[model samples]
Target: MWLLLLLPCVRADSRCKSDLISSINITAKLQSDILLPCNFELTLFKSDMTADIASVWRESPCKSELVLSLNVTTALQSDVLLPCNFSPGLIGLNTTADIAAVWSHRNMTVNNLVEITLQGQTMYWKNYNRQIKTFSSVSASGNFSILLRNVTQSDEGLYQCDLFNGTGCRIAYQEMHLRFDDSPADGFLTWLVTAGALGGGVVLLVFLITIYICAKRSTNSSNESVSRELYPPEVPHDAVEYTLENPIYDAAVQSETHSSFRAEKGNSAETAVYTAVKKVKRKERKPEEVQ
Candidate 1:
């Protein structure tokens, strides 16, 4: 009898275990429709889950606190979506709550843009109206994301989303920036400075190359001129060392001519050539022999 009772209790315990999720995994895009996967749920994800999700899980006196995750960037006059979704155990179980997304310019507290609310309404604080809307079925899907249509320069500031439930209230803050393009002159000035720097570099390089070539050519010409000056002009090598050797043949010829002239009779009346014999000093070829 006790065994039969324990079997029923075990079956009931197994059913309850199957209903509760063991682990949840999800992946999503920013500022877009959040997908609820029936296959997997999203549980407390952070490693220190107790610190962040204690408010979502604790009983009766529960509290909610939000963290600002991402900053949004957009251009003026464009329709863009800002992302703000809070995940808690209550949003998944109840499928609704007092969820609100408010956009506020810094220093303008009274003029808040209560653009999107989970109660399926859009309201403004300063009596201003624009096409700002949030998804109606987002609560059912546990997403409280909003969309702003035709944004303006004045729309640039901080945005907040406050969540309220039986737990407590949590506030999330995100910054929105309106981007502007640089002025025409600013762009032109940057281009002008860059072009001038590049052009100056090119000109300086060309000038340096020209100077190098000219200097090399000048050095070569100077070397050639120096060589020319070293070897002086117009003095012949043969003229510097040549000697006049008379060979004494002229004296021998005059002596022989006088002998012949003496043989002739009428040569006495003309310039007479006399055969006078004298010893000629014979110099040795390399002069020291004679010395």
Candidate 2:
């Protein structure tokens, strides 16, 4: 008789234990963070209580065996998005349902990163100093995804997402594996490009300077050649010597003429004349032909 009364609770527990399984693998670059998608649809039913004792009874229209696995890779100091969403239609449009989501990491010292609670149109969040965040209107859309800001090596681990109904019974479960890349090659490549640009600039400057110097030397040499052509030097001439053998008058003739003129003109006026003379030596001829 007692077993018959507990049958309903056992069946309800078994139904809640059934889950849907999924798997995903992602390869992300070191430049940006990665998004892990976890989306599913569920039907939530109203809880029932037994008359004799207070027993929570819940139901779900899910498969017997369901599993979801995600592999994500990202860089250090990058933000990550762990997506988790469910269909809100099954919660009923005119009815109010209490739904809660909890995000935790197994390897992290602070396991509970975020906790969200939704009561119909109202939503509440509990996180660690805003390090983890979720949508403000999570109740309307049934999106329980969390954002991890500035992920580091400590954030690389297995993350679990659990969903509970008003009765505090877990209805859904999800798992995600976070990982980091071995090396960050993007930063190194950027550095290399910058260095190459600087080197090219230096080489270009040197080439320009060399061309300027060569042009200056050529211009100077051309100016000197033009000056030599425009102005020439004067040449020196040799001097010549001259000899005068004849004069204007003889000295004895001039004296005799002067005396006759003085005697003839004893009672008249006398005239005087001036002359310049140069003497030369004469060579004698041989006189032995008569002997």
Candidate 3:
């Protein structure tokens, strides 16, 4: 009966010793590189205290297995990244233990651990050149982050972390992706060029219209001038009609008078007889015939 009671107690003791690790918490914007933070708890002997951590790996939602194992620290060094930070109270593994971190796609690793000593902050990476660039964190106790910068699309992968300096290890994991985006400057420049073209076109159109108007006005002025020269204001004219029928008769009468006077002077009797015959002929003719 006592063995049975102890059996339940032993089972409870083993269960209590089991390590419980929290899942990594990660948040990031789309099209930006992110480092999914992974942290874990571990049970270790006092001799097993070192900065090196082990059993770090990564898994993706789309995959069923682990991808890359990080053993060499040099391999974890990013061309554009700073080193990671180790948790303080949980740090100091045995010197013989190697620093190992593994992830998917042969990219993730644990290079160094930052000692966190403040509150209200955590460590993360901004990518750079297809690798980690910056590591930053804030904690109330010790260094707590590895930051990366200038991440490229190819740097996207899954990551898992563990404090494995001892027999018992704590584990946590997160997902990360790197994204590349085109520059908006190109779009802006294109819009600028289009606007410039449109403005130029409008100005050109206005100029053309102005020229046309000026030309039309000039043509109209020239036409007016020509019209004035060709057809000037007119003057009124007065018209009358007259007909002459016996102008030569008047001249013949005068000549006859002069000749009769000259002949009468020479012979009074001949002249008196001629004058009486002439006067009788004149009385019988019309008044218009006498001239």
Candidate 4:
């Protein structure tokens, strides 16, 4: 009864008298405020035929599963998203030109959710100060999902996402339900996620450092082995100690006394005999030598 009050009768404008309903039927999650897609048509109402547009939330016949599978629990005043994808595959939608989208809650025209041209531009219709929007991802990818921000009790209801062609023909339908309730925040889950992320990051860093150090050490050892193989180690040269005991040292010292015997490296070898004698004056030795 309340929905019928919102059904709009099209104006005499020849351009506006097209049937908004489509053959495509939509399915949604149970026991929640659902968005029910009405083909290319949206739930709309007009107080007078000349009004700019009628409200949508109070009018859409989009029904979630009457059977309660499970309730989506969210805190009041918290933002929630009710997913509704209006894929044309549901009813084999084809368009010669670009397609547009219109979203409605209950039976009203959601100007904020209206997209006149497919993938062209979006016009936002404001209800309250609240931010309700369709995802841009849906615009590009054909997934028509809307976002409800700062939800209130009044916002809990059915929703509809409809697709339209360039000719203003509605093509696809989808619906979903979102319910916000009062619930305490799960502090343990938040803390656990934070700690887990930190721990994982620390472990990853440590593992990388260990791997780098081991690789460096292995590379250094490999280089050293290669160097040793390429150039063999040389044995140290032997050194000799002399207290005038070695013949080479004694011969070198005595060679200075003999002028005719030059110690040239190219000269013929000559033997030398070493004997120690007491120092005597040459003149005194000369008398003994004459005798």
Candidate 5:
């Protein structure tokens, strides 16, 4: 009996933990739809049964309060049912609630009001006109999404959404932005800068190459000209080197002639015959001329 009593007390304490669990997730785009998902887990204070389950929504984390609520017995096969028509324990309430998605730019607030039934049913409101701007929102997508038509700089700002029930509320927020299109002037300037740099580099390279080629050509021409100017003229292949032997031969021939002359003056027959033979041998030789 004591064990049973202790178990009930422990179970009761777990049920009323007082910590409200909620999470908000969103993705913001300029000219597109932004989806913000609201997920919550509720634990009843006295019992596990979701008899009087209530959720409230607020903004500013602590200041803004009571945006919406849900208070109906949800059908098992409804669209808002967590994890399909099954898992009845994941359902927040016995019935689906009206979830309102709000969008704010500057200080202007455009309320996109819609209802989502159990098992994720979405109700869209067409022609829900907001102010004239570069953005539009689809109020029918009960998934707390802000759909902007055309994005602009003026459309950039903060946005918020609130999901609630009878007990409390959960809030989700986001930001939007608009930017100007790039001008042709900017693009042209960029292209011109790039082209100028590339052209300058090419021109510099070509100039250096031309200078090098001219220098090489000039060097070769200079070498050839110098070689031509400094070279000695050609000479015949058969030219001979001068020597001292020619004078010696002339002296020898004159001495021989003088001796013969002396011998003839003396009228010696033997000397005359010998001189005549020597002169004949000399005439027959016909020696090469010396330089």
Candidate 6:
């Protein structure tokens, strides 16, 4: 008898577990746009049911813990789209179904951002009207994706989207974690690249300057060596040392000096011969007196 009772419970537990369809994680950059996707089929809910009993789970009441987990990372000042779409699988295209979606931030205050109803295609903004936006064809396309513009630091936390029937029973649930990107690592990488480029440029400049200086010094040294080899300095010679060392020059000067001395001696000899003749006449007069 206990086993018979447990069989239904086991089947119901398995059915509830099957409702959990998808879990997604996304990473996005700062100031960029991102989308968090959540999609499910709505075949169990009948379209012929009245708006008050639109949820099939109301009759068979499953556990409320079937939640879709989504983790999303983004930076400040970003635009994010939290998606929640349902397909009317078995429900006829001509028939209409009533569904409501509520988006809320699960922080210190469970702040409701917006509520969208598919019946009259009505949208009610609870808190952030200016920052939150949605597609006009949300009811037609069954897309309850909410666009959050210019997300701030206060937006960092868990966000939830709850789909309810007209009876106010939540049939589907999704929660997402929004966080700031690790921007410091990107900044450090950018700084590293910039510093590396600057250092390389400085090193190249220093190398070029060194080469220029070395080339200039080498040119000056080469010019100096070539000038010394080509135009050697002249050394002056002493005249007396040159004349004494040369035999031909000494002999020519001695011959010219001896000729000049002989000419002067010949003139003196002519004058002395005339004076000796007068002295001879006086000696002859002295001999006549003696005779």
Task: Report lDDT per candidate.
Answer: 0.56, 0.62, 0.43, 0.54, 0.45, 0.67
Question: What TM-score does prediction 6 earn?
Answer: 0.41
Report the lDDT tens digits of candidate 6 across residue range 194-251. Answer: 9999999999999999999999999999999999787654422122121224444443
TM-score of candidate 5 on Cα atoms, chains taken together: 0.28
Which candidate wins on TM-score? 6
- Shift in Å, residue 151, candidate 3: 7.2
lDDT of 5 at 209: 100
Model 3's C-alpha root-mean-square deviation from the true structure amounts to 21.9
Of candidate 2, the 10-residue stretch with the lowest lDDT total is 234-243
* lDDT by residue (tens digit), candidate 3, 1-291: 899889988865765464656665688899999987655445442233332232222321122222223332112223322222344433333333422222223355643222222332233233222333222323223233344444445444433333333233433222333323445675788899999999999999999999999999999999999997876543221221111343334334533544444444564444534654565566558676867
| Residue 78's lDDT in candidate 3 | 35
The sequence of per-residue lDDT tens digits that candidate 1 reaches over residues 1-291 is 999999989966754454655556878788888866555444424455456466666553234344554567765567777666655654545435565555555546635566555555666666445566667566445455667788767666666655544333544444444344555676898999999999999999999999999999999999999987775344322232211253244344543544444345444412321211121222333467757
Once superposed on the true structure, which residue ranges of model 5 sit more than 4 Å away at CA?
A: 1-51, 54-170, 175-182, 235-291
Q: Backbone collision count in every prediction? A: 1, 8, 44, 25, 31, 0
Query: Alpha-carbon error at 242 in model 3, in Å?
Result: 20
User: How do the residues 181-282 of candidate 4 rate in per-residue lDDT, one tens digit apiece?
Assistant: 545465666777999999999999999999999999999999999998876454221221224335555444555443233433333224432321211233
- Candidate 1 regions with alpha-carbon error over 4 angstroms: 1-64, 90-92, 96-103, 108-110, 115-119, 126-129, 166-168, 171-291
Order the candidate numbers by lDDT, best to worst. 6, 2, 1, 4, 5, 3
158 Cα displacement, candidate 4 (Å):
0.9
Candidate 4 vs 6: which has more TM-score: 6
